[model samples]
Target chain A: MVQIPKTPGPSSPAPRPVPTSADVARLAGVSRATVSYVLNNTTSVRISEPTRRRVHEAAKELGYVPHAAARSLRAGHSRLVLMPAPDFPVGPLYSRFISELQWALGRLDYTVVQFGSVGLHGDEAVRAWAELRPVAVLVPGAGLGPQGVEVLKGSGARAVVTLGSEPVDGAHALLMDHEAVGHCAGSHLHDRGRRRIGVVVPREHGLESFSLPRLKGVRDALHGTTATLTELPLAYAEDSAARLAASWRDLDLDAVFAYNDEYAMLLMRALQDEGVRVPEEVAVIGADDLMLGRLLRPRLSTVHIELPSGRDLAELVDRAVRDPAAAPETHKVLGATVIHRDSS
Target chain B: MVQIPKTPGPSSPAPRPVPTSADVARLAGVSRATVSYVLNNTTSVRISEPTRRRVHEAAKELGYVPHAAARSLRAGHSRLVLMPAPDFPVGPLYSRFISELQWALGRLDYTVVQFGSVGLHGDEAVRAWAELRPVAVLVPGAGLGPQGVEVLKGSGARAVVTLGSEPVDGAHALLMDHEAVGHCAGSHLHDRGRRRIGVVVPREHGLESFSLPRLKGVRDALHGTTATLTELPLAYAEDSAARLAASWRDLDLDAVFAYNDEYAMLLMRALQDEGVRVPEEVAVIGADDLMLGRLLRPRLSTVHIELPSGRDLAELVDRAVRDPAAAPETHKVLGATVIHRDSS
Candidate 1:
């Protein structure tokens, strides 16, 4: 048949239609099942090497990428690991930890998709996550409840890891153990003969999940000691630090655990501005052992935290996914130690 | 016919089947079309209020949520905004900005999914993102090329917004103007009678994209000035900072503009440890007006960047998605001004 060429129109170009697996299958002269198997690299059924090569060539020529959603539906699973968004002021330490986790998950060929769970809560949040049908869900903070975990399991998530104070039923736990961090700080301060210790609790909304536990641990550690525990409600603002600095003499705190390195730096600068001598008048210690902390004139003391390497957590997720029938396990992933510096 | 009651037998619990829209349709005594319309709140088709109520009740009773992937396939588009992961050490200011962006997107009824793109590059990264079939892709940093954007568009991405130094062809640009930031700092220091200046270049992997442009800007601003520019290679490590600090006197730089507030604070602390007086021996300035900067002893001088509000970016994304045929536009989303504090 002879085809007649038509003149070009003056209209805008229409969006090109996305090629489907069926089109690839038709081009390769094979069944759609064969296309899916070859594209997804499913090895359950045997196929000739030539057939696979033909299918692949057809897909490449047509620029056909197997729809992730369609493939997920057919396989009853997906390569998505849904991590609930950390809706808080994530410090450098936590940020580094998360990047490492994503890298580790990537090595295992799982796409770590951070689900924006900002306004979503409770079962509603779970239902939203479930709709995406992620193979695994990592719910950080106290975002997911037991019922939510059950919903995720019912929605076909083989692995549900919750990072918080404790594990909810039906989900593996990566307990942060914030209390231990505070206890470590409290005991260290007490050992250094510091009485009247002040602990900074940042007046931020979401950080309370991490801060409150640390405060409790400090209180627990200072129970039988001569050190008097004082709760310092501090906002991460310059004016707030200035105001706290103005009343520093009235509070008369001998030592302070300023939450983390960032807060400690802020408060330390404020105190120094008020002409207070480091360690001589007030000893300051923070957590996270940031590089900047060591650069301070009176090198800032810090609680160095030891978190389970990203590889360990990623491996755990893989194991749980591979063996779904096994009982969900809880692992304490955070350990804390005090690094003495000139400031303390 | 005789009706007989069945007796319960002891057996292990089987995997619970997920409720589908078909189950809801069956229980509601309506067609699957009616169920889909009611559940998705589709406006085209008219359904009776009572019928809609019945469909909703059935869905609620069965604990069914519409599969997001399936719904996207049926609707020919998805409400997903895929943002390439920022693998660099993101400062608190940038972190907060990203969180704001996610929150704003959520407000506009869009789910912002952060795609981890650490190891992936070029066409492979685009293919990975396109497989999810997101309606829009927000390429942060220097992640996407012109060809990559074309690949994404071919894979059905309706809008591609790139945040970087320059706009890629066929993609909307949220130009960060890193060069302007550097120029602002260099000029500010030049005006302060500093004859020589040191600009810290972070030795991090991913940050070069931002740092290099800023360095170029510094060079451009000081092109005809008597001021000489020195590149200070610094890493986000204590040993590196200390090593640089030891050589600070030998460098003989009158002023230093560290990359950002975090790095400036680190370098300033190091200089202080080595008995270098701020603003006397060396003046320092950083970017991003962090609150901690104000609390510093000789407070940190900084370049205050005005990034486009998240709501504005989100609205732009929505507008672009709604009107895809419009010529791709470029928006200068970041502006910079030097905030002269005590350090400078």
Candidate 2:
């Protein structure tokens, strides 16, 4: 037999047992059922405000928090909305959308959690999520496939909603196609007669999910055209932008689609410093019509992406959760349009 | 009695029972104990690679997942490390730091989950987090007090850490003071022979945790100095910035600290369009020393902030988890200084 040491630690004296509703009831001089009624606000039973306050105070004094697991079991559902953390740092627009979504979910009494998905991939990531047993999941990006959705459902998920370019076979889809953003920018540049275009693709990890689709869209738009497309790998650093700017003349690109406004702002400033005149020498465009785009000297032309309101998305999630076996609904969530400015 | 109405969800037939290790064992033609030994990689007992593969395959085929709660009970600890989601959109530096931290935690076999904290506050937020039963928590900002820490510890949290201006009474602290950033920016503007300094305070909610401290820091820096500080409320919108710029001359501010690089870029561009020359007529400075600031024509001066590496912070969390009874340690995580450039 393996013997355990007695000196468990100096700071943690024989640990006290975790307090329960009975502890609160004892402290409050009430029955356990009465404590529960006051705490849970059993509307059918009339509990005086003073008694409710006494129960709450007793619970607080004991540092007692109702166990979510126990509550979930009793309620026949866990009000959990799980999402995978983005593989990389997203821009402000997407960030704002997420903030809105979280706020709306909170209003609907949902507990939203973003799971770290750094080392996991594809169906494996889905498996990791299934272990969490969330009532609903809202996934972003194309990594989740039909098989992944099946795994979630089999694990007792009431709802599996995805926001990506294409719909997963068994999941409700929030169809936000990044390709449209790129296609709009490409078509706008083409209509303006800017050929020999350079597309600035971010060299950041996880951005490939968005960048690759956008690249494909640009390729589709410029197909059978006179425009020559060049893919430029650029990191979001001054040194990377400077190196690209130094080699801009040799590449001889007449125009540039610099991913989004953030990148466009970075690359355009570098090009301007390199004495390359905007629109005259090399027209530049970006996606996401952020206010920063308008602040540029040669104002940045951009693809303004309008996403579905967060309230609307929250309602969609609630509906899906209510009827898990309902037909997988697909909603187009992208409104990508070109906003012309001086740079292009 | 309220009979909770039940409906068989349209597509969901009577659900199958959740698969167990015994089910995997049956499918793999092995005993349950043998399956456990193989699947859990019990080093004491060697199993053939083929048997291990068979066990894994069987587990996968059966869609079996080990219950985290059951496993936690067996192991005497859970793998959960909880964090409150940022109240609003944070800058890139913080986002990258979070990603790195999550990756590091995952490497240490901890599952990191960011809980949405939209409408919760102080002790209320701590109670909500405790209900989820995270083994460890890393909170940012001053929302958590010593009482909250006690509540968390009482609820079985192995570690409680805070990253904010000051240390809480009973929690490990990652002491990152925004006041230092503001002081640096404020002192730099003062030293540059600029007075009547205007500080841009974002009107956005949740930013008060950062912005309010920064504003106070500026005020603290110029307490006895000849320079006068004016607080300007601004939203992150073109219209808001343009309005601020239209009345810039009337405000008669010769210098400004526009919160951070993003806001600095916005306001500077607006001021330039409004015919207020940068540095010559009105100097501008920001914080976070973002690459975007340097990409500006008159390179933006900024407060360069050095944050502790994610690996280091992860180590802190790990150590605290291991020895929860140890004295709460405080570490400074801020290195804020001014980087002079053309704009200032």
Candidate 3:
């Protein structure tokens, strides 16, 4: 027999192959089934505390973690919660909201996976997501149709939740009444003796779904009042702001509801650069009550928004996933109020 | 034998279950292997064009999609590129960078999954991330040690990339060189004929990894010059900025380099609110050269940063995944150039 030369190194047995649950079971002097029950915490089967501890310790020593795919196959479901990434500029407030949601989902022992659905849309997008067979999917911003939801359900997705302006027929919906936000800002300006108001609609694509409704709301609020609304399309660029600022005198307006705090700040600086005074010359208001707003000279007045607590959303997802056949439900997840400050 | 009563449905048929690859193969009058090859675009299999067309048509008619988890298990790897969520606040610049990265990865047929690693750290964090069996894991900001990298590699991770100040022994590192950003800002301020320079260090958790080195760089540049450096620890809050503004008289700083555009904008507003003059009294400089900075009354001076293009990073990830045994590589991701504006 030929003796193969061993690689020269520390004679430690070539680092042990990735240990398995069977290795843990053998180390703990128990059956693999018992190890599974203990490690997975299957309450249906009774096991002694000492035995459970032993199984856990053995598994730890061997660095044996059950393969997620295999475990998912046994359970007939993956512990993945997919959230479609929003294809718009996510401000600090939205970022914080997502962070909270991810943290809450993690605590529930669910892996939150962000599905980047940037270019894909409608049924095609749903099919791509369904291929993953995630336990649940949270679709925000993009509107999902009935057929799209059906495809996901047929593909074994237990819970399908949609967050948008209104409810979809098949999936659970978290309605965000963005129009109310615009109405609040517009009304505040009207009451403050501003007759002509400019509503800044960002020129970026994908925001039309949001900005259109906001514009309609502003118009709705100023319907009976003597105030008039002007649509000012602005892109998030210095030249855009400067160009708008350059024509500030021609488009005479008493106040402006610049999309959000970021836009508001941008326009405010441009207006100031053009020697236009804030509040005194043109009252300004924004939304998403950011702290930077407060630091502004004439502290930015804004429409404050409140989103549903992350725990509540997480709980909803879990409940829906557990009883997938249950009738779908809808809830309002956004509320808005105005924060009157120096700017307005 | 007992007879079972069939539930009454429109007499035609009830809804069919999700169609499988086998169903497509049967409908196409081809083998399941042919269907798999056609659907997955497998290059190794030489199937005639007519057969491929038949399989695809059958699949579209039957609405069949190969399960992601099942396919991953069969292939012994997942097409997932996991990026751990950064613990620190993600500013506009970083957010844009990540967005670009995600889009690029998607074009390369990789799903970018952001793993929430807010609290988890070290080996525990690595194990948690490994449970999903992602093909590649990108750890940014967080410092991952050799042991953690080993754990990931042992768990079947093909590539591990770290973005930080320095390269880890095992993982591929994308060096940020943040200190250069500070040195550039400091030198620019010094050269602008400003005697005293104050560098703002945000006292937010998880920012120390970035802020500390920036402080060091400022100190390094001010070594021989007859100038002074003061570290101002400010939280991202109105009160913090207001307090800092109140004490601005005592600090007597002629120039300030706030962490980045966000912080610079915040502090500049606070300073203005406190009746401080800009450029004449205090020249404020920032980093990231945001559009908002340009719109400022006295345009903000910034250290313009250049991040590696998304395509470049995506190609690196692909290369590393293709050849896991290649010597680990390091890339300089961040470059800086000072844009002196009205503020300085």
- How big is the positional error of residue B26 in model 2, measured in Å on the Cα after superposition? 6.3
What's every prediction's RMSD, in angstroms? 7.7, 5.8, 7.4
Clash pairs detected, candidate 2? none
Q: What's the lDDT for residue A45 in model 1?
A: 87
DockQ per candidate: 0.27, 0.30, 0.24
Residue-wise lDDT of candidate 3 within B1-344, one digit each (tens)?
11112222222222347677889989999998888888889999798999999998998777776787778878888998888888888888888888888888989989887877755778777888888878899999865898888777776778899989888877888888889899999899899899899999998888998888888887888889999999999988878998999999999899999988879888888888899999899999999988778766678899998887776788788877887776678777788889989998
Per-residue lDDT of model 2, residues B79-166, tens digit only: 7899998765788889978888888898888889999898888878898898877889999777888899888888778889998888
Worst 10 residues of 1 chain B by lDDT: B1-10
Residue A187, model 3: Cα distance from true site in angstroms: 1.4
Q: Would you list the clashing residue pairs of candidate 3?
A: none
The lDDT of each candidate is 0.85, 0.84, 0.84
Task: State the fnat of model 1.
Answer: 0.37
lDDT of 1 by residue, A152-182 (tens): 7777888899988888887888888999989
* The best candidate in terms of DockQ: 2
Estimate the TM-score for candidate 1. Answer: 0.93
Give the per-residue lDDT of model 2 (tens digit) for A1-344.
11111232236443345678899999999999998788777899998888999999999888787767556645655888999987666788888888788889989989899999988898778888877778899998768888888787776678898988788888888877888888988888889998898899999877887898889888889999989999999998888998999999999998989999989988997898899999899989999888878888888999998988788888888887887767777777788889999999
Report the lDDT tens digits of candidate 3 across residue range A282-312: 9999999997687676889999988877777
| Native A-B interface contacts kept, per candidate | 0.37, 0.39, 0.27
Per-residue alpha-carbon lDDT of model 1 for B1-344, expressed as tens digits?
11112223333244467788899999999999999999989999999999999999998887787899999999898999999887566777677778888888989999899988868888888899999999999988886788888777777888999988889988888888899999999999999999899999999898998899889888898999788999999997777888999998899999988989888888888788789999899999999898767867788899998888787888888877887666777777678899999999
Candidate 2, residue A54: the lDDT equals 91
